[model samples]
Target: MKEIYLIRICGKCKKTNILINEEVEDTIKKGYYISCSHCGSKRIFKENETSDLRKCMDNNVYKRVKGKIRQVHSI
Candidate 1:
């Protein structure tokens, strides 16, 4: 099976991270990512025994779509 991932979305500007993290359901729902991609809100994502490395979209684009895939990373 393909690896699933989770993401964080900004509440203010609706900015989201381009880099998807291999996170769990609760973790993503609780809100991940250390900060916002656009407005740069200081979000404190609790840490565990996971790596802290991530990649982000430079233009801060919002990927809009409406579809369903067989493998999905719930958030």
Candidate 2:
């Protein structure tokens, strides 16, 4: 199975891409929106939205997962 991360932008703050695991996928699919911890913006991103914010996570970032990340290596 392919792992997926949900990406979203804060409506009020318009910053930060919030990523959630499979556990929250049900709530999202049901039309519930997420709130920003900083600005309390209630927003929801679609399932297919793509963002580079995941690559910038300092703590959870990784170099390679079998093969090197294509875009990061290209740069």
Candidate 3:
């Protein structure tokens, strides 16, 4: 099966932070801190965060299908 991933969209500056399946699992396991590199918004990875991540992934898929992939700065 293909690996799944998520990209977190920063609420403040609308930047994206990519999180692989492994990373997402680790975050959920360890309860690690996640921050947006562009906007510096911080949050803990938990159940709610996972749902938000799913939403972000879904939005990305929708944008991709519509041929509207966003461009972000190099990290």
TM-score of each: 0.32, 0.43, 0.46
Candidate 2 per-residue lDDT, tens place, 1-67, comes to 5445555555655554546556466766989866776677666444333335564443232366578
* Ranking according to TM-score, highest score first: 3, 2, 1
lDDT measured at residue 3 in model 1 versus the true structure, 0 to 100: 31
Candidates in order have lDDT scores of 0.43, 0.51, 0.56
- Name the runs in model 3 displaced over 4 angstroms: 1-3, 43-75
Supply every candidate's count of residue pairs whose N, Cα or C atoms clash at under 3 angstroms.
0, 0, 0
Best by TM-score: 3
Q: Which candidate, 1 or 2, has the higher lDDT?
A: 2
Candidate 3 lDDT over 1-75, as tens digits, reads 644555666666665666666776787689776777666887423222343445544433323435765543424
Q: Candidate 2, TM-score vs. the true structure? A: 0.43
Residues 1-75, candidate 1: write the lDDT tens digits.
533333455555554443345444455588763566556886524222223322233334334356531212223
What is model 2's C-alpha RMSD? 8.7
Clashing pairs in 2: none
lDDT of 1 at 26: 51
Question: What is the C-alpha local distance difference test score of candidate 1?
Answer: 0.43
lDDT winner: 3
RMSD of 3: 7.5
Candidate 1 — worst ten consecutive residues by lDDT sum? 46-55
